[model samples]
Target: MSRRWLLCLALLPCAAQDVIQDWIREIEQSGGGQVLIARAGYDAEANEIRLAPGTTRPELFAEYLHQLAFVRELMAAQALTVSRQTPEEGPLHLILINTARIAGRRDVEEAVIGHELGHAWLRTLGYPAVAAGNSVANCLAIHATDAVQHILIRKELRRRGIDAETPWIATLNDALDQWKVRPLPAALTPCERIQTASQWVDVRLGLDEARWPRITGYEAQLKTRYPDIEQAVSGLAAYLAGQDVAEKEVNRRALLEAVRRLRALAPPTTPLKTNQ
Candidate 1:
């Protein structure tokens, strides 16, 4: 098959968001309706954090809210807030992104949002749990783990017969490679930068299976639901191991849409907004 064909094949999994949504709908349909997601409430006193017109994608917006809710739950578990401002205390904060500028599609954006939300959730869970020995080392472990998970997702795609030439997979790997060699800036907080670097290495080497049992548990859960995950990941892992570009610009436009979905959740803001 042509490289372009492989790219399309890879993205086919992401295109099945509708099927995933259907599964969610089925749960709701079956009265297994549990509201794990929390919505941000309106705050009259706070500034209305309006997003620009570029930030448009209702499904992604809804998904972002769901992710925020998930993170909020984690925060509640640790008795903290993801931001300094509570849902009711702050403005109607909306994440805005230049949908045109990012590198993937709407589904890609969805994946990115999910990952970013995971970070927010982690912060809410309280890093203090790991703050010992070397705080910088701990932070590095967390951030690096997140980045590694992103690459892992790309790997999963390949196992599903999705080609590496696809824009999302290609860019995902490119990002991972660039991150591996990039040096930490001296001005950055030691722990945070360390965590960021750790994440880069994690993406390059894979998540540390020995340290985090929770990670293993989640992986098992995802794989249980999606059996093809192993195949997808294995394929990409093999490609990355060999430095092979298996796919090429199959759906550049669609890929860009995916990135937009991500930005809607975690808009690249100034000063790199950390979990407040």
Candidate 2:
């Protein structure tokens, strides 16, 4: 067995302890740590968020949820909101980020970055240049793109000896680690189950097979459904996916441009407000 896995196994129990409490304490205090969790319109009383009962690790899951909300609010404050109701020209708002389960160990950062990329990638798929945020198809696409992002940057991840999966995995060994634990209707329908399982399998297989790039197979799937988009956006996704920490890198430029385009395309936010 790999030393990394062994170390992780040994650490899981400690991880399950007092996660939500720690997060509450951190965000409640003022300083960089509080900055980590706070944002406009975020009601700490209501929005600090909690892991549902089914999550494999409530502490880790809750901590990552805090980061997810932080990132979403950060982007909005910066005017990079990812959508409009339709492609026909109107107020472009933020993309609706539907949460999906990662059945593997990729970090929350990768998941966040990959999801935004998913929104951009879908635009090219002609999945309706607008209205994606609200669509059922968008549900699976979110996980699909995150899976693609991991395939792209995982080499850099491993080269640094960083575990490609989230470190929190070290803490949770059971169903609590699985996912949302859902909504008022927690049960997924038959189709939702298939979509969920398909994505989970995609990332798990992609992570296990070191030599195979999952994007190749994913591209074939995309090509089948949206041939035109497959030709246009795959190059862009590849360009952004290949980024490293090097200065003035081409992939970095591509990444910036992709984000810039999304931001530029967004509609001006209507000045609005209220307590949640």
Candidate 3:
């Protein structure tokens, strides 16, 4: 291990550090390559991950490992880049966690990291990719694919005893409250519509309506607020709800259909503008 990784492990509590070390060892033994970690941020304007400022490197890496220790399956990833940016992304096995969003909250950290790691796990399982040429299309593709993936991620998190639903419920309720006070614009751009609708779908699919009965209320509110994307959202939800089997083929098919449904929501004339 490198000196930086050693420093990162040193900053963690003894138990967590040990667990991380064991995970790293297993990856190495399985020929998965050395586990690399960095404190970084994604420049959305530039569409790249770069070293971020504000937090010390050691502190950031330690916080990442602390949350990571809870999700052993994430060790399948050979590299983890923790960022202090909003809107996390996981391309292949390279997972990014938005520390800024978590803000030192343990439950939020675990849930978010677990969620991102679930994406990584799916990648290792050969999950289908959503292809697009431009930023707007790419954003739509991402959200659409995530609609299906969130279902499995939530199921896996529950199996592992992680409370993934609470954090998302809190976030959705907060966003709804804020939007009610300020009100959304009468019109929304395709990117904005897809992003907002995607968040709602994520929570809707991930939340256990049986346990959190109020999710139905939130769903109704979201549909009321964004009437335009309701068809796409509902279509994706229905398609994913039928994907009860967790087998690879079922998920692959669900993702393809989900992506197709979401992409259909955006007009073909959408400009190739970069995401803001």
The backbone clash count of each candidate, in order, is 25, 9, 0
Instruction: Give one digit per residue, the lDDT tens place, for model 2 in 38-71.
Output: 1122335785444333333234223334555334
TM-score of each: 0.30, 0.31, 0.67
Q: Candidate 2: give its CA RMSD in angstroms.
A: 14.6
Candidate 2: Cα lDDT at 83: 35
Q: Candidate 1 residues 1-276, lDDT tens each? A: 532233234322546444333433343344433112122322346632222232333343444334443333222221111222234433122222222323336454344333333333333333211211123332332332333333444554344333322333444444445544873233444433333233333333443345332345434433454344334334434434443222222222222322232223223332222221
Ranking by TM-score: 3, 2, 1
Sliding window of 10 residues with minimal summed lDDT for model 3? 70-79
By lDDT rank, best first, the candidates go 3, 1, 2
Find the 10 residues in a row with the least total lDDT in model 2: 30-39
Q: Candidate 3: misplaced stretches above 4 Å?
A: 1-92, 131-133, 208-210, 268-276
The predicted structure with the larger TM-score, 2 or 3, is 3
